[model samples]
Target: MNSALTPDAVVAAERWTAHNYHPLPVVISEAEGAWVTDIDGNRYLDCLAGYSALNFGHRHPQLIAAAHAQLDRLTLTSRAFVHDQFAEFCHRLADLTGQDLVLPMNTGAEAVETAIKVARKWGYRVKGVKPGQAKIIVAADNFHGRTTTIVSFSTDPDAHDDYGPYTPGFQIVPYGNLSAIAEAIDQNTVAVLLEPIQGEAGVVVPPAGYLTGVSRLCSENDVLFLADEIQSGLGRTGETFAVDYEGVQPDMHILGKALGGGIVPVSAVAARRDVLGVLQPGQHGSTFGGNPLACAVGIEVIKLLEKGEYQQRSAELGQRLHAGLETLVGQGITALRGRGLWAGVDIDPAVMTGRRASEALMERGILAKDTHGATLRLAPPLVITADEIDYALDQLKAVLG
Candidate 1:
């Protein structure tokens, strides 16, 4: 597909840096499309896609070309001066997201942080909420980011405990439970932030009508529906966004991960003018946010999405993936859930732990990751072909047995 890496570049692959994969012992030296070659020359089919960060696969030609072109011209202005790529990046993103405005940031965490600030400001300025009384509702077992404020509302002990004293003004509700959300809302509630499908929580897809219900509840209570689509957006879930399955439009969108086409880091929050308009100059900003290089890569990402082929591949191949996974349920998998090319397989604990199974899969030349003890997550790059998908499934089946 993308011949971004020539033969010379492939041979020049660097050694793995230390500590990133501590104790895993897998030293990846190079990658192309849906496969990675370890330093010792072993190749593995990639199933995690760098936690969905590399949705377009490694070294996609278009994304790399944009990055190189931008490098030759301009890189940074620090938001102090306007650059040529700024408006075009933001404008295309706005149009893509079907929103009135967009505020760019450097990472998913930064985008979520921006949304939080915007929501709080909107609560006080526009919603007429009293100072220091605003609250945002979040789902349980959600992974927004590692920021102190984000982890403040995390239900996972690993992410929550010892990270305190935690921030306040947020409420936790059961994911996929509309009644719980309705019961938790109050006059001071500023927004309801959720992942359309919780990624870190073993790719948990909410119950039917869950997304639309949340949208309705937010509208009824005048609270902004903030969809943290960082992992679930950008055609990873077969649609532009996971929420599109229900045709629900969130008031604010928090996007990242694949937004930079797995090259540079680019994140943004898209919302109506009345919502993001609450922020004044100097209220909050990042020096590297919306930089020329990030924007150039982001524009290419948007253009690729506009083609609709990747999304179609995911949707079609996803059916093939799930169909294969479905046959393994009760044999080794306790449960299976996901959308598009993404899946969460719950290994039977009696057979082996998810970690051990992942190691077994790794040995079989299929790379994947385990989450929360017994659940294994698979989000292969969209560039992954049907044959590769079958090969991965065969390896997984052998591992489970």
Candidate 2:
């Protein structure tokens, strides 16, 4: 075992906390860029990137500076009263997304809930859908969030089982099927909520032109296209938004994760004024939604994205990463799927389970996560270099061998 993999710490953590997460054995103490050091000072390359939350890398200098500067100033003020940092954050994010308004929230799930509320309200008020009859079509195998309403439509048994009585008014359709989405829509269908690229479902990218078709259908049917970009946005897929690759824009963009620059929890729903304006005063609000600290970190994140360097890096490096992973197919990898710096690799079940492959990689100083049965999800920080990518591939090859 690696010196950094502390058995005692892992045991203590499991004993103290709920069994909500089955984390790897290593105990990370500090992280910088795409690397982490455990308690024993053993280092490992971070391939998960906190599920794309660390797109700019851990403890980025500018993000840290913004956090520190905000610490000396202000933090929370709730939605009851406005704060100095609120407008700039909202405006810049709106500009970045090319939307008219923004509703800030603290987490990805909260933003999703906010979108649901806004969509339902818009359906009732604008689309003239009967109250309590507004329906939103969602994709199967989707991983929106763990909220009661969000998980109600989840096709995954692990996420759906025991989560209800479950919320209603959602229609489930197979992802990447435009015909299913079109067939599911009706007079009462308010929106089609989907992840442009299903992140947690092993970074599954939908069929080409599917998003464009969805956009056109939504426009024709007067239904909203709400894209949950929480995990796939912010330079992860080499674009500002995953839908951008298809030249498709959703009615509302639900954003999170990297929006906080890995410094704080920040998320928002960006949409046109008419769509989000359905919510009047007292309709929805959050205490820490647009707090100064979150805005500070978010502003820096937007600024970094505005430069377009990280997106370019993800595009260029992503090609190299995918090329390398592609060469591994039939050797140990059964399949590979993804874009930019994100990939879901299927290890041959004959060789080992995904969890076993992850453990082997961990022992080799590369940290990654396994999903499903034999699929590994790799999303390294955008700051990782070409040499680091080659090193990780070498380690993976050794583990599979």
Candidate 3:
């Protein structure tokens, strides 16, 4: 055991914070690239990457420089007044997404909520749906966010159980089933919201043609196809957006996690002008959504994506990662699913629980997260190297053995 594993720090954190999260025993104090240093002076490879928020890795130089430069000038103006960094960030992100409008927010959930609101409004105003009758169809076992309204439609008991009287107007359908989605839509249906790749449901990838089918269904039904790319976008899936893989253009994109370049909390909804333009002044706003600091960091993130180097790295390295994990199938891993640099490996439950496997990996100086029962999710920074992926796999092999 590493002598520096500070039990006292872990105990203190548990005592002080809410029990919403069950974190690993390791306490990271600093990080660089794909590695983190714990308070105990132990170094470990970071496989989670802040749930894809750190896709570019912690404290990336360009993002940090942008944040620092913005800090010296201005931070917040409350959306009451425009900041110099606002238009540029919005313009660049809009261009990058191939969308005409952007609505900035502070988190992924907020962006999702915004999308919902906009979709509903568009339904009432443009689609001629009756007021208070607009419906949006979501997926089963999907993890969008934890807000009350978002959770109301969640199939996950942990997120949905206590948080009701649930919000109405959302219909749940079996994910990756285009037939179910097609059957669910009605005259009142305003949108079909889904994750291109379900992240929290163990990085599940839909069958080929699923995304395109959803797009077609939405188009035929005159319903908005809203892709929540919060976890799978911004180079995490070896592309600007996972829906890009199918050459499908959704009506709206809910983006976050990596848009701030792992430096600040920045999120947004990108859509066509006619769709997002439905939001007039005072209809929606955020104090810190498009603040100078967030815009500064976001602009740099957009610039990085525009270069397309990170997306390229994710595509190439992701192949290496999946190939390596395939070798472990039936060894300890029972199933594997993911795209780009993200993966979900299902360990043989007879051998160990997912939590136990995560703990074992921690002991080996590697960090990963488990979901469901025996499924472990690995989403390393796009900046991680091939050698580092091999090292993490080596650690996994030992842990399973």
Candidate 4:
């Protein structure tokens, strides 16, 4: 902004917005694969990849085609009426998640809220918990979404503060600590919700066997395990799901972000019939939950996942990414945490703040974002090649140097 007249789009956005997000001043106009071109016609490698929402990359040909075809046929029919594309996406998604049923929603936060409602109902009718006393345990530092209920359990001051009177019934526990979760679960507990890898918490991966222990503890306590895979899922973590690394399937799989294949906003909670089935017809519904356009794009997303190329690429290319990143440890980076194409890089505070590092990287033709105080979250599109990864690493090295 200081070097040039701030782009009109960026200026207008700042002039009209609520200032909720402090995004770096870069106005992207178009994108494909792993790159985006600004309105000024400068292309930068898209390192954030829309926080894993672009796992399949921007305007994926197949997904675009599906959206186009569906747009020509039908767009929104609401959940009141069933569209031809609805059941296909739901069924395929259920199959992919290996769940008995799938309930679609428009955003990840909606899916989380749906899961919370279903879990509470299940506790009342199925688990036989006291109607008003049903309790759920969540990890500290978890980022499910910014909804009021979800924010109630959020430990981050930015998301949690000013968002009260907070919802009750959620018990906070230390993430990755099986002992903490076990001690928190009581007879009135209905579920334990977690993100296998705490994406917003700087791609925080838990200790080994932590997920398995949580799964076992939930099973022993007759509690439902809800895994929020909205960010670390859909082939972003070098696996279909980060929990896949441990082969631990939660009772409910909360999915979104990449499920729309960067085409539309789509999300869903995949769970066995008994758990999600607790919702009565009038109890839960979304007008745009399973609309034709979303389902069409979602179906193509599932189809692309079924072939397994993206997951394989994440697994194989991830090594190259991390290996190069690891070399920067002492040079400027303090540490790294993540799996697959996703990473949370901690820049040495003595060297530079994450914001400064991000700006430096941006100036060098790479666009990565910062999270916490000094951590950078990088999730490049899965389609990025070896050379692109190397280029990003080289730029990062220069920025840190």
Candidate 5:
């Protein structure tokens, strides 16, 4: 190991890596559970959880143990030959989703891409739409991923800037508006892709009955309903999925983030066999998709989420967390919105901007990042305890005060 690389790692990364993300200047070295230690050995609670990837918290023993065991036995055999752990992962993930099939992918973006491909293929084959003319409807303010096809429909200029010629055949509708979704549909529209709650758009929860209304509309319109649960699923919303709040079932589910249990990059697209089965032998695949190591780790993650009462913990803790934050209303806060443990705090302009508040909180040893100008999101790991929540809130109050 290089000692020099270990010390000035942040600067070195900035010098070499692409200037893509405007990340906070924190060089995290080691982490365990819901806490992280920087290179300087200063500890801070992990509030963001890798944007909800570490729902089981950092270095969960089960996940780490699974990875270690798999590393010794096997890592990658590729899709060229079937591996032992792949079937277990696929079956467990499909059962957990109550879907008939699962297509494993290595990252959240890949899972989204898989979903897009499945929807398009199904449109042409099952729905009798022309190959080149199939259209997918996406919601406004949606954050699916950064692929060229994914970003082509993004409403964010920053995400789509200087990237063209974009993919065609996608329509946009105002989020949380069932009427807009219904109006956007045409004969060629194959699917309606959405995030039940817009996490990147500051954890915006839609109006009541919006999801069920959209589900019913899609059922009537024959448009496949795809839920981008990468950020809102796996118990982040105090339920197994944000869609559970409405008891709505989407035709296809794009899931990632916490599926790896903060141990590896594991994601999957789940749907009925008919929808996902549109892909033939050469239609879609990834080299590392469903490899042994990721499958083993992913299986452990699912087992933990299912066997343990993590979702219930998220629900109960979410109420306490939101109630605690509600007490801060009219203090330095302007607005607050969220579901489960996820929260978007709007600060008064007179007090501080979101960026400034984030910086202040960092100085006080609590790591949270800003979303929009005045909104800061708090999505701590679901494994976080009550005492930790109080401590994080105390830091928030102190910094805001």
Candidate 6:
């Protein structure tokens, strides 16, 4: 940055640039592994991990090296013509996902959009649904993306209010209730899309066997099951995908965030050829979807995940973290819910709300964010060490005390 570009300097730029996000007060300057340094030079443990985009941690060396090397070679060649990087990325990502094909996109929202189109196409061709009559089932309180088409199905007032003439053909059902989902499906229903764990819904984990039940219901009913793993995938939840916890696989997987290894905007939809191949050449595409830089970083991300220790680390650390927080349940908390390294602790409203606890944690040098009104989410990077967890827990205890 320039000499004039302090934390305040960057904040000033954002004030005039866009008002879209309500970011935390801390202005991060540099990051490595599971920690970030502020412009003022104070370091804090990053528990949010860019809302799970930094699952491999901030500025991971391998991901960074891949980006640097790819930058030296090539960046964007677009998808209009094939670059050497696109094919390998498609192959590796498809192989990793255990899917027959992969459709690349640049952000999580676009992947959702792509999946929506793919589902509709499959409905038209395979399921034999009439054009313009296909319906998709989404859960209430879902947070897929902010795109107009995606938000039209949202049950949240804040997400849908004033965004009108909304797209139709979406059905809403209660989350985690398999019967609700099963009942909501009709002949027009093409697919059931839901998060394996509602990460943005305060890390709400469904009842046991809900995923397996959902998969079975979808299979028996002949409706496609789409999983939005953008926030909960890539070992963030102690599995390659959160669905792995129950060994439940969806028809289509929407992935983003950490797929770029926190280095670029890389996202995609992974599915069997019969499902994802719904998109013909002229149907849909993005300029930077399978660019070389993103592909390189993504390849490195897979390598890191395949190294096979990070997921195990997250599972073990999550147990320790959950156990530590369980000890705080009667102290001042209402409840706790989550899986792996992702947790949402509900502070007793009588003592504190999520906002207040977030502010307290920030002041104590452990950064986490609040969700809803009373739940604080703690989703540290999967690579965080035991000492880091101990430090963060100490900060939490100090703040809560």
lDDT, candidate 1, 317-370, per-residue tens = 999999999999999999999999999999999999999988899888888989
**12 Cα displacement, candidate 1 (Å):** 21
In candidate 3, stretches whose alpha carbon ends up further than 4 angstroms from where it belongs are 3-5
Model 4's lDDT to the true fold?
Answer: 0.93
Error of 3 at 194 (Å): 0.2
lDDT value, candidate 5, whole model: 0.90
lDDT of each: 0.92, 0.95, 0.94, 0.93, 0.90, 0.88
Give the least accurate 10-residue stretch of model 5, judged by summed lDDT: 1-10
Q: Give the per-residue lDDT of model 2 (tens digit) for 180-252.
A: 9989999999999999999888989999999999999999999999999999998999998999999887999
- Best candidate, lDDT-wise? 2
Write one digit per residue (lDDT tens) for candidate 5, span 36-148: 98877778898999999999899999899999999999999989999999999999988888899999998999999999889999999999998699899898988999999
In model 2, what lDDT does residue 85 have?
A: 91
For model 1 the local lDDT of residue 26 reads 65
Q: How well does each candidate superpose onto the true structure, as a TM-score? A: 0.95, 0.99, 0.99, 0.98, 0.97, 0.96
Candidate 6 structure quality by residue, lDDT tens digits, 1-401: 12233557667868787776666677778899998887777778899998889999998888899899999999988887788788888888888889999988999999999999999999999999988999999998899998899899988787888988899889999999999988888888899999998987889899999999999988988899999999999998889999998998799999999998888999999998889777788899999998889999999998888877889988999999998889888787778999899999988888888888887887778889988888899999998988889888887777777
User: Candidate 5: which stretches are off by over 4 Å?
Assistant: 1-9
**The CA-based lDDT of model 2 is what?**
0.95
lDDT of 4 by residue, 220-313 (tens): 9899999999999999988899999999989999999999998899999999999988887889999999899999999999998999999999
TM-score of 3: 0.99
Clash count, one per candidate? 0, 0, 0, 0, 0, 0
Cα RMSD of predicted structure 1 = 4.4
Select the stronger candidate by lDDT from 1 and 5. 1
Q: Name the candidate, 1 or 4, with the larger TM-score value.
A: 4
Model 4 alpha-carbon drift over 4 Å, by segment: 1-6
